[model samples]
Target: MKKIKLGNSELEVGEISLGCMRMNELSKKDAAEVIENALDCGVDLFDHADIYGGGESEEVFADAIGMNDDVREKMKLQTKCGIRKGFFDFSKDHILESVEGSLRRLKTDYVDTLLLHRPDALMEPEEVAEAFTELKESGKVRYFGVSNQNPMQMELLSKYLKDDLIINQLQLSLVHTPMIDAGFNVNMQNDPAIVRDSNVIEYCRLNDISIQAWSPFQHGMIEGPFIGNEAFPEVNAKLQELAEKKGVTDSAIATAWILRHPAHIQPVVGTMNKGRLQDIVKASDIELSRQEWYELYRAAGNDLP
Candidate 1:
């Protein structure tokens, strides 16, 4: 895997990171194999959430791999908090408690990064800032970021944050191209011209915040990947054509499409299957040209004005 300087942070992370949301469902033996394959593929970053399998994912990860000093030192671990049973909380107490629970579950003293899982409506920037300050000073979290937030939301939080927000996780893929679409259809009188994210991609780029692309292969919201889905024949055909040309799997083509962006979007693939994981990591070595990238975009049901 190729490495990229993650935004303005001091950490250099792999171009592709593994998402361990589903790892809780795997047995120790199966999860161990998955982690081994990821390490072999040079994937050094692992993403998690406090709610993943009710925190069993982190426990399983620690138990499965026996994460000792050597194993923990080899990779970077990141987790998100702030989401609760029926609401979101960014209070200082919740933020501090979340990281403490994560560290205890993962059997680690610190996580390389921590993210606010989602925007909390009642979030007070001052409280978040205080929590982050404590976490940073305590050596519990080295960097901080947010997920599913637009530019203005980020701006509001950054106003009180003492540290640079190193990352902003968002959804981006071939079929789910609203952010990219709004960019292309700017000033046009079309549905795609309606901006949804307040130009978050450009904002993050200007602010030196890396955008982590989650669900890289899914089409629509939780509709599953479009690679072999019969509903997306055109995109599938185009993906297969490019995959054949590049001598890689279609899934790699899908992932490469995200990596080809100039923003240096890092993909967080959540595949537990070792074979599929290896295939997706091939995207790091594949580069799609401008024309090819646009072609895939159009094939995914978008029209250029």
Candidate 2:
């Protein structure tokens, strides 16, 4: 139920947001239930991408909720672009075209935020600046961000952008935590100490760019949830232990671990089941202590130098 300022913007959103990547798989009736339940659980932000469900997710979301002026005003909608069928495109024309498509599908006048889905090696910052300026001037996007970008990538984009980059979406969880692992094992000669993300956590914190954790419960790249998976028994046991102590589900404890970090990272949950959604939202209320947080971290088989 707690809200935080979203990056450098004036928007105050819930600590936990809903990720709509799999919403297209649900029926309109079921999707409606999911949306309604999310709002009831104090989630005010929804994240999407141009290619999710082959663009059917956005269409289904709008139709399921029977989107109206009132309904649109109550929640913050975020969508990402740049990734194409066979390549990444940050060209001005592609950026412009992508937002128009998203708007038409979402039935919204403007998205609360727009993000580059992933890094585009062929990106021209000048072209991106031009596209973003046009979108801002035309009232199609209110804020801008990037996903899976490192500090240098963001810095390069920031140099040409007229507006500040507000959010950087990344993968972070108990099992998939390279960003956090490198921080603890700094300067050590270990696999965990190999810095891959360029200290993005510290970069985001110092720059006030909110890091939105995309897979808080997943172990690998969309492999599956680790909460109840037999492969992750140690962490699951630790999660269960903490859940019982806090009177919440093991999933909630996992989510709370992400929220406990001082960086103020927000987790974008993608569960479609209303009951599971409610259980996960309980994470916003539970606060994990430093000792408990590290215990869960170590139980996940992560080594410290």
Candidate 3:
């Protein structure tokens, strides 16, 4: 896999990141196989959230990987906090407590990156800055980021953060692409013109925040993967054609579509199936051209004009 600098941070990571949200469902043996497969595929970043499987995913991952410092040093581990049982929390108390929980579960002293899993409406940036300063000073978290956040939201948090927010994880894919759609349909009286998330894609690019694309194959927030979903025949056909053309799996074509962007967005693969993980890695080498990228955009029922 290719290596890319994580935003303005000094950490360089794999072009593709593995989302460990599903790890808790697997046994330790299976989880270890998945981790080994991911490592063999050049995936070096593992993304997690405190709420994922009620923190069991991180625990399973730590046990599966043996929590060896020498092995951990070869990869980058990034986990998230800021969400609570029924609400979001970014209080200094919550942030500090959450980090401790994560470290204890992951069996690590410090994570490579710690992200706010989601935005807290009642968040005070000063408290977050204090928590981050403490974490950084004490060697608990090396870098920081956010997930599903907008430009102004980050601007609010960055106001008090001593370090740059290096990442903004977003829900993006070939089908669920409001960000790309809004960029082209701007100033128009159409449904696609709805500027969601304050057009954070361009904003993050301009601000040097790397985007991490989550659920790259999903059709909607909850509709699940679109690869074999019968509702998306056009997209499935297009993906099949490209997959055969490139001698890669259809899943790789879907993943490559996201990585094709100049933003250098990292697609966080959530699959635990070893075969599927190997297939997804094929995306790292196939760079989609401008026409191919737009073809996919249109195939997913997106209108250019």
- Error of model 2, residue 293, in angstroms: 0.4
Which whole-number lDDT from 0 to 100 does residue 257 have in model 2?
Answer: 94
Task: Write model 3 residue lDDT over 174-198, tens digit each, in one string.
Answer: 9898888888987899999999879
The 0-to-1 C-alpha lDDT of every candidate, in the order given, reads 0.94, 0.94, 0.92
Question: Which stretches in model 2 have alpha-carbon errors above 4 Å?
Answer: none
Clash pairs (backbone) in predicted model 3:
none
Q: TM-scores of the models, in the given order?
A: 0.99, 0.99, 0.98
* Per-residue lDDT of 146 in model 2: 96
lDDT of 1: 0.94
| Window of ten residues with lowest summed lDDT in model 1 | 218-227
Count clashing residue pairs in model 1: 0
Model 3 residue runs over 4 Å out of place are: none
Candidate 1 lDDT by residue in tens digits, 40-61? 9989899999999999999999
Q: By the lDDT metric, which is better: model 1 or model 3?
A: 1
Model 1 misplacement above 4 A: none
